[model samples]
Every structure is written in structure tokens, then in C-alpha cells.
Target chain A: MTTKPWDLKQCIKNYSAKGIHGITIWRNVLEGQNLRDARTMLDDYNMEVVSVARGGFFPSVEEKKRQAAMDDNLWAINQAFLVRAPVLVLVCGADGRQPLEKSREQIKEGIIRILPEAKAAGVKLAIEPLHPMYAGDRSAINTLAQANQMAEEINSDFVGVAVDVYHLWWDNNLQQEILRCGKNGNLLAFHVCDWNVPTKDFLNDRGLMGDGCIDVPQIRGWVEDAGFSGYNEVEIFSHKYWATEQKEYLEKIKNAYLKFT
Target chain B: MTTKPWDLKQCIKNYSAKGIHGITIWRNVLEGQNLRDARTMLDDYNMEVVSVARGGFFPSVEEKKRQAAMDDNLWAINQAFLVRAPVLVLVCGADGRQPLEKSREQIKEGIIRILPEAKAAGVKLAIEPLHPMYAGDRSAINTLAQANQMAEEINSDFVGVAVDVYHLWWDNNLQQEILRCGKNGNLLAFHVCDWNVPTKDFLNDRGLMGDGCIDVPQIRGWVEDAGFSGYNEVEIFSHKYWATEQKEYLEKIKNAYLKFT
Candidate 1:
């Protein structure tokens, strides 16, 4: 999670105490924990578990690794179901060993392979299209239109999209694609963050909403216009913020959310 | 250039000596030199000037800055003409102070404003759509589709698009867009570079062709299939490579170009 100092219980307690009632739980934080207890803790705090952070790294050149990824995803789906998280966000992967087209095909196939279990468990598989900067290895699906195309072809209600403003905001076609996503009832979740003018790190240098140049409020208007009345999950992956006192950072997040988005 | 250590004359001399006759000239390298002398130098080496590296930074919150940008573009067009370069690449800029749409609007307006000068100079203006990572402050046009739309709307024989594999290989729509660009007679230049898997720096960490994950030859094939018969420019911007002895670097470039593209 972006709040690097906090464990799962600390996250629930701190976020809810700060009146941030909805939280997305990264799969990493769920390690060495009982799923039922995690659910109970969420219930105790009266905090909603918005979505499971991730479940897919589905594209790999090795068949054994692909199968292993599938198995891991199944485990993640079980975790999401047990923790009462309605959505499992997937950062669909790419393989440097193969062409991106091959990676994309593998991603689709991987998702299809795991769809039945996700459906059986009642957790929507939300494909979060990553920034194209990550196209080498993080994800082959780098645009909403591509994700939309795949989701449409798959045609499963349990399969949808997670629109993170950090990733999708750069796209000129974002508003139109969001409309399309909503029209098909495929807009499953929304994540909020800013693209810093000088993004120092590709993976973990995301800015709080107003700290960067992204027109967060404008994008929020578009997403809302697309009929997504869901959590604007604060998803800032900032080394700067994470290094700071997280309580102060959490306050900053709240203020940024209120002021900017 | 990516060969940051070399000046324009050295670049022409060394590149041509290495049988890398085609060169794209960045404006900074022309600052103190007489355009006539520069042209004569290029001719002496029997080097082909493919393009002037850039011409546009047309978006700014300040009106004065926008006009200054226009003047700079005019100068760039003149330089392209004097240098006998057929094309001037435009990395149309974004203003951090405004929304991306506004920046995009200004980019189109800027190109339109400069059209007459470019036409009069007999130098085609090629819009080089940057990667989305730069959409915050570098270029609002981050996709071939956006560039195509702008070029089509501007509707000038003097206007076209530059396809850089580094900025665009991630797009699933890239092949389709290349076809469309060719059909519209808008594909003016082709630039090639590999995207390093763990790209350390956003601006200057481009890898040599076969050193990274990009399918350069495949993209080259797509460009050729789309009716583009042009030099595949090696446009790497690696700090790692630039720190090396540039003559040896040129050898590496030649090898990568041959092997990858």
C-alpha cells in the first residue's frame, strides 16, 4: 500500500479514524494474516474494503510460470472473496521475452482461465490498464480502449476495468472511453493520484492529487459523468510521502482529495 | 542527439564516416553556427540531413511565451530550409498551468499559425507525438491517433507525423494508425530506439536497438508495409551511452541498427 508504515490493521484503524471509510487492500499486506480476521477488522472499523490491490501478473513466456501466475491469482481471488472485497484489481503483465502482442494474448487467455473461479467467488476482476511507461514488463494493456476491447470480447459481467486517473489521465480519449466503459457496465472501480511533472521513479513516485500537473478534478468530473459513483481511492505511490510521517501524509491525502478531486 | 558529446560538425563527420549518412539536427547544436556554413559542412561530408530535431513548444500559460515559441518555430523552419532538411519535427508542448485539452488546443493552433511559414520554406512540419509520460509538461500529443487527427484537421501538404518507436511501440493501435498515417500521406519520418526494460531515467535512459525489449524490426516492417521507405533513425537518448566515447558509440549504433532494425 502507499502507506508503507501501516500494516493491514493499522491501515483500517488509521483510515477509518481519519474518516476515510473505504480502503483498498494490497495483496502484499494480506500476507501472514487470517482472511476472516481481516474481514472482521474491516467490519469492526465500519470501513469498506473497496478492492483487493492486485491479482494478475498473467503474461510470461514460460508455461510453468504462467500456470503459477494463474494459481497465485486463484489464491488472490480466494483472499478477495474471504476479505469481502468486491473487486480484484489486475495489473496485467507483459513479457520482455516475447512480442507485446503475444503478451496481450497471454493476458486475455490468463484472465479467461481464471474467470470462472472469480465468477464463482462473486469478485469482479477489474483490469487496471497501466501507463505505457510500464509496457516493457508491467503490463501489455496500456490503454483504456484496449482494455475495453478485451473486456467486451470476454463479455463477462465479472470482468471489468479499474480507471486510475494516474494512468488514464494522459489519454485524450479517456472521457470517451470512460463513457463506453460505463455504458457497458464495465467501470468497476476508480483510483485517484497525480502525475508529477518530473516523475522521478516509474513505479513509486506518484503525487498526491494537487501536488502535480494532472487535472484531477476535471478527470473526476468525466468519471462521474460516466456514472461511476464509487470510491476515489487515494492511490499515491510516493516515495516522498511514504518516507514522511504517514499520519501527516494521510492528512495531506484527505485535504488533497477534498480540495482537488 | 543521443550522442550528447558530439557537436553538429563532428556528428556529420563521424556519422557519415561510419556510413550513417542520415542525421537529425537538434536546434541547440545550431545556436552559434552560421546556417550556410553548417549546410556546407554537411554537404562536404556527403551527409543527408533528414530533419531538424524540433520546432514546437507551443503551449504556455503566458501569451508572450506562446509568441516566442512561434518565433522559435519560424527560426526552426528557416533552419530546416537553410540546412536543406525536408522535415522539422515538432514536440508540441504542454503547459502545466492549464488542462491538457487546452495544451492540445494550443498545439493545434500553434501548428496552424506556423503553416504558412513552413509552406513558404518548403519544409514539412512533422508532429512528433511524445510518450504519455511526457504528457504532463512536454507534449500534449502523445499518440499517433492524436497526431493524425491534428494533421488531418490542419489539412496541409506541409504537415505530417513523425513515428518514433520509443514513444509509440506500446500502443496496440500503433499498426492500424501507421496504416492510416501512410494512407493519409502523413508519415514523414521514422525513428527507432529500444525501451530499456528497467528504464532508469524517464528522459535519457533509452537503450540501443537490440539491448532492450522493443521489437524494432517488426515495427520497421510495419512502417515499410505502410508504404514508408525512409531511414530508420537511431534516436537513443541514453546517459549511459552518451558518457562513453562517442566514436565507439557510433559503432554500437551501427551494429544495433543493422541487427535490430
Candidate 2:
């Protein structure tokens, strides 16, 4: 893998040099950075920011905090606009404080509330359905089908879903969902990661391309067959990977993408 | 937790005391002693062994090993009968040297080949759908629905599935699948374990009931509501759980179950 730190500029430069046309950014990387500077960097590297880290997590106990969450999303949308990112990923937050239907309604309203800003900014919002393990805290949208349902209910081309392998590999309806997304033209972003057996940490145990058990190539084939032409952004959260030199990690990423993905 | 080694007799004795009607035995526990001796122990305790450790894992590069694997399964069925184990849990083997689909078909056939013997022995076969991370090297069956589908194909109450929370907790359609299984009279065994955030080992590293993130009681309710009045067998494969004495571990199991499940 690449031995350098996970600097977006270096990643874009490397991606561009390697003929990769797109990249995805996490929230931490975008925080406090000069948006215009990031924009200039992306233009310089000739790379497209396919998707922003995420928004959502709308369920909160405090009403002010929930509103603040929406405001934070607005800021994220603005950042996406500045960086020319086409999609803003939303993770449906889990707060089972109310009846499930009420919670669902709240989430739908949350997404609807943010859609106009996202649309005005010319940024497509992609809802990312996480694994069920994250259903309590990270996302209530736990399947591509669920995301598609939310998107349809919201009724906007500006809202769709981003499919990541780590989250969707276990679905019996995966291929069917992919076909459905493709047919609807709702597939916005494709992220790649492995599901390590005996996944140690829910938050940081994500395997790199070939290190875990997910059949990435098969999933990629489904997406491709479904007409998804986007970046296969590698997103591993392994401690070992993070501990290593980023440059080395990048090299490994390149090799793993070629060899496994 | 129980203070001594995990003896089969103690497992039976303790199981009866707690009103938990069944036990799933591991191969080590079964193999360590004579089959008749184990049966005698269960008989003495007046406890039912719900399922035997395992069978399946049919795919192999070597033909001899593959056949031997089946032979071992037949032996397991015999043992299951001896111990009054109604079901034999299968960890469907992986691709081995063949293609994934081919291996899957081979495993299906292997199961079919064993079904007659299973039926004759009055032992139902419960196919355990492992988590997708185990799809490559463990079981090809990776979803409750898939297991149900297989059961339908087999067309027998003798063939169903063992629902392990650690494996199926991440599924988005869990509620629907559990209902499907219940409706079809295919819900067989229920195993409980927690999915820790950072699962350290694929084989071990399972959490005690409530320590991990899984909404255990919620899932338990789902199962019970779905008409499964079976064993809430606590199966923790964690190094952390094993480090303590068996007595302490048993106590933890009881507490976790009473509190969470």
C-alpha cells in the first residue's frame, strides 16, 4: 500500500496518475479544510469527488441537537458543492425512542428537509444502508432495497443510494437490489471494503480488498452489469492498515484492487 | 459460570435445572468420550441434546477427504441418535478447489446423500447459515432465507436451519426471514451469541450475551414470537470467555441469558 498519510491531494494525484477518475472523501478529512483549496486541489488532480463522507444520524434525544444535525448536513452539502462532489451520503441513524413508524417518518422528513438544499447545491444525496450491527447507532437504512424505498418515498432524482460491499454482501436479494437500482438509475456511488470473519471491531475491523471474505469481484460484476460506472473506492478501517505508512497502504490498495477487486 | 471443565454430564445437568430444555454439543466434547458413554450421560440427566456439534463442510480438493468427511457425518448421525440429539448442525463446507457454485451444489448433494440416513436415524438436519464472512471457507448457506429455501427444496421437516444471532444479526430482512421460517415450520434451532464491535478472531472472539451490540432480547422476542419454544443455547466462542474458568464462564452465561435473553 501507499506509504504516505491518507492526504486527499496525494490520493487524488495518485488516482489520477494511475488513470483512476474518481475518489470519495470522509468527513474528518473535510473538516476545517479550506473548501476552495480542496476544490482547487481536485481540479488540479483532474479527479471527481464521487461522494462525500456522510450525513444523517437524525435520531437524537434533544430537539436542538437534531436540528443542529440537519444544519451540519447543510454545511456538508455546501462542502460537496465547493469540492464538486456529486453525491452526499446519508447514514440513517438509529434512535428507537419512538414507535418505529414514527422514527421512520422522522427520518424521511429529515431527508426531505435536506433535499432542497442538496438539490440547490447541485449535489445528489445518496443514502447508504449500513449493516444491521449499526442499526442501533449508525443507520436504520440497512439494505439497498430499504434505501431505494426511502428514495422512492422522497420522490427525487437528487436522492438515491450508495452501495458498499461490506454492508450489502450478505443480502440474499443483493443481485435483485442491484438490478432494481440500475433499472431506476438510482445507483450513485460504489464503495469497496471487506468483511473480515470474526470482525474484531464494529467500527475499525473492516478488511482491505482481499484480506477478508467478501467476493468483491462478484459484487463489482453485479454493479457493472447493472450499469454502474463509478469509482471502486477502497475503504478499509483495519487498525493494522491505519497503523502502517499511508504510502505503503496505498500501494497495497493498488495491488489489492488489481488482484482482488 | 460452572467451576469445572465443560463436561457433557454437567451441561445436561445444568441445562435441566435452568428450564433450558436443550443443549448443542461440540465435537470435542462428543469425541473425547465414547458415544455410548455420552448417550448414557444424557440419559442419566434426562436432558435432550437438541443438536450434535456439526457435519457438512463437504467441498474438498481431495476426493478421499471429501468422502471421509461424509463418513464422519454419518458417524455423527449415529452419535446424535445415541445421545438423543434430534438435529445435526451443519457448517456447510466451502469452495475448496472448485468454483463457489460448484462447491455449493456439491455440498447440497452431500447433504442429500446424508438425509436418508438422517431420516432413518430419526435425526433432523439443521443447516446453520454462517455469516457471509464464512462463505468462502465455512458454510455456503449464509442466510436464514437461503436455509429455508434449501429446506423447501428438500421438502422435509427433517431439514431446517439453526438461527445463530452472531451470524444473522446483521441481516436487514431478519424480521421477514424469521417469519418466513416460522410460517413454513422450518425454524429449528436457536443459538445465542453477541457480535462484538471489534471481533478479534473469526473462529473465536464471540461475546457473552449482552456485552456486544446485538439487541439480544429483541431478537429473542422475534424468535419466540415466531413460535420457537426451543433452547436459548448460549454459545460464546470468545477467547475472553475461555480465559476464565468454566465455572465462571457458566455463571456469566446464565447471568447474560437471564438479563439479556
Candidate 3:
């Protein structure tokens, strides 16, 4: 995980050595590095740049704050373009000071504004619907249906949905919604992680696949059935794993991926 | 709240003195107390029994555990009968070892097995759909739509759904689902609480109404429009509020109920 204390280059080498096919580059990892150097390192290690880790935090109660977020996202889009990642994941923001509906509108507006730049740069924007528990502050877009609706409304080739099992495994309508998303050609990415039963931390208590209750393979089957042939991106946020040895953790992740996903 | 150290008699006296309209009795508060005495105390205070706090934990990996859960639920039903509560709220349980569909089927089976006893005792069973965050261990029924479908399939005067704004407010289809529940004559209870923006604890960080992002009054309006005329139960689990002065907290609750609900 990014919480581990590895430098960007070291992380790429470690991932490449472990036969990890791709890496989603967090913006923080690129803070002090040159984008060209980062791209060169990825190429040297045979590590495909999956996507820029995140770009969206579009909702804000203040106009100036909203403008600042868009400005940051535009920068992230450029970074993704420079790094040769095809997509920028969006954790569309929510402002507790306003209603969720208002925050949702702000997210839509923000995405529409950024779409032209993203398309011109050949970088798609993947709208990731967070879990409902994060609806208060992290994101107002908390369901696949909502993401699909937003993508449809935007109607842009560069705007689509990212299917994360952790956020969506609990919904009864997930399969149908995934089908609709794929039917509309809006499934941009597939994220894999498990939900621990006694999930201790709201954000960082994610389980590795095969260690929790999610039927990841079943959901993967649905994604493949719906014609999504993208990377099965392993996006995990875990305090426990971050504290462990990076090598051992990467090995475990590979095993879990083979066995459970 | 039940987490408070007050016994049943004292709680009733305190609630009555505060002019609280009703109390939802938890099984723990009834320990070592005579049910007749509890009912007499409610009558003496001229307070209504809103509903028994809970009755369901019906899913288990083991058959014996499942049977034991059912037995405890049947006893809870009898207790609801003795206390003159019209409904027993069900926090339908989930087993982490199995698929969610299995846990859901087991919950349905458990409910059907107990429906006759509940009907005979004249106590309605309200399936409380928890938030998806609790789907792993608390309740597999995590949407108003799922609860509505389950209740309709069960089809009895005694089976219905409890709409909790804290759990269901993030849902975009909530109003439509509530309408469907009402149309099926399955809307039984409504619980109120706000969701703190940075919810510190998953179980006990709930905010008082108007203190968090949820529009409680909006959800209440939707419930009312869907023909639910029952008591607006103030169900909150908050470590912060529990650590504060109980009298002050109860006063705040009353004000919040009047102002927001």
C-alpha cells in the first residue's frame, strides 16, 4: 500500500520483481519526482502504469474552494498524461455543509469542466462510487447506479465508472447495475478488495482478498461477462498490511490474487 | 440509550418525568425485573411501549446456533407481548462465513419459522434494514428495497419494515422504496438519528439530529408521505453523547425530536 515507506522508484522495482503487472500511481508519490523519470522507471521495470490513483475532490460549499479542487484535478490530469496512465480515478467529493444532492451537482459540474482536457490528453476519468459509510464527507456518489447515471448524463467517452467490489459487493442490484454500466460502455476499471467482518477502521481496515466475506471471483465473473477486459487493480487500504514487511505483503497479495480473484 | 447504566424502573421514571412520549425497551434493561411490574410502571407513567428494541440475530454457520438464535427471538417475542409493545424490531443477523445470499435466505427462513408465534402473541415483527457497512456481521438486509421485498414475500400482517434514516439516507431510491413498503402495507416503524461527517467509531459515533450531514426531517417527511404514522423512534448510538450528562443529553434529544423530526 502507499502508506508503506517506499520511494516511488523502489516501489516500482519491488512491484515489478514480484511480477505485479501494473501500479496505480498516487499523486503523493510523484510530489518530488520528475514525471519523465517516473515514466522511465516504469518502463525500465516493465511496470504498466494502471491509472493515476485519484483526481477528484470536486464538491465544496465555497466557490473558491471548488475552483481550487478543479485546478488540482487539471494538474493531476496532466500528470497522468505525462506518466502515460490512461485513466484518472475520481473520488468525487462531498461537503457536509450542504445537502448531498447539491454536492452531487457540484461533482457533475466539476467532471464536465475537466472532461475536455482529459479527452484531449488521452486520459479517461473513472468515477469511483465510495461506500455509503463515506457518504457524509468522502463522496456523495456512493452507488454504481449513481455513477452510471452520472456517466450517462455526462455522455463523454473519457468519463466512466470504476467498479470497486468493496464499495458495491453489498448491493443486491450490483449485477444488474454492472451490466448496465458495461452495456453503456462505461466500465473503465475493476478494483478488488475484501470487506472484513469487524472492519475496525472506516478507511484503512480493508482486508486482502480471500481474507474476508466478499465473493470477489463472482463479481469478477460478472465484470468479465459484461465485457470489461481491464486490469483487476488491487486497491487496498490496510493499516495491518502497511505495517508488515513490504516483500511479504506483496507475496501474500500475489497469492490472494491467484486464489481468490 | 441502552448503553447507559440505568435500570428499567429508573429509566421509566426518568423518561416519564421528562415527558418522553414512549420508550423502546431493550432486553438487557428487563433483566431481573418482573414483566408485569415493567408493564405496570409504563401504565403508571402513562407512557406507551414504542417497540421492543430488537428481536432478530437469526443467521449462523451452525444449525445449533441458528436454532438458538430462533429460540431467543421467540422469547423476545413473548417479552414484547408481555410489555404490550406492538412491534419487535429485527436487526437480522449475517454470518461472515457464508455468502450474503445464504445469510439472507437463513434470515428469511428464521423469520418464517417464528411468524406464527409472533402473530399468535399479536406482536408485529419489523425487519430493520441496517446500513451496508453492517452487512458483514450485523444484518444482511441493508436496503429498504431488500427489506420491502422480504416483507412482501413473507406476506403477513405481522411482518413489516423499519425505516431508519441513519441507515437509509444515503440511498437515492429511498423515497421510492418507502412508497413501495407503504403500498404493500408493510411500513411499520421509523427510527431517527444523524450521521456525523467524520464518524469516529463505526458503532457508537452517531450524531444527534441536526449535528450531522443527514437531512433527518427530509427523510421523516418521506416516511410520513408514505403513510407511516407510528412513533418516530429516536435511536442513536453515540459514545460522545453517552459520556456526557444523561439529563442534558435527554433534553437535547427532546429538542432535536421536536425541532428536526
Question: Against the hidden true structure, what lDDT does model 2 obtain?
Answer: 0.78
Off by over 4 Å in 3: none
lDDT of 3 by residue, B1-261 (tens): 533656787778888888875889988888788999999989999989989978898999999999999899999999999999999999999988898899999999999999999999999999999999999999999999899999999999999999999999999999999999987889999989999989989899888898898898888888889888888888888878888877778889889889877
Candidates 1 and 2 compared by DockQ, better number: 1
Estimate, for each residue in B49-119, the C-alpha lDDT of model 1 and write its tens digit.
Answer: 99998989999999999999999999999999999999999999998789988998999999999999999
Cα displacement (Å) at residue B150, model 2: 0.2
For residues A8-70, what per-residue lDDT tens digits would candidate 1 score against the true structure? Answer: 999989998899899889988889988889889999999998999898899998999999999
Better of 2 and 3 by DockQ: 3
Q: Interface RMSD of every candidate?
A: 0.9, 5.3, 0.8
**What is the Å distance of residue B260 in model 3 from its true position?**
2.2
- Alpha-carbon lDDT, every model: 0.91, 0.78, 0.91
Clashing pairs in 1: none
The collision pairs in model 3 are: none
Best model per DockQ? 3
TM-score of chain A of each: 0.99, 0.93, 0.98
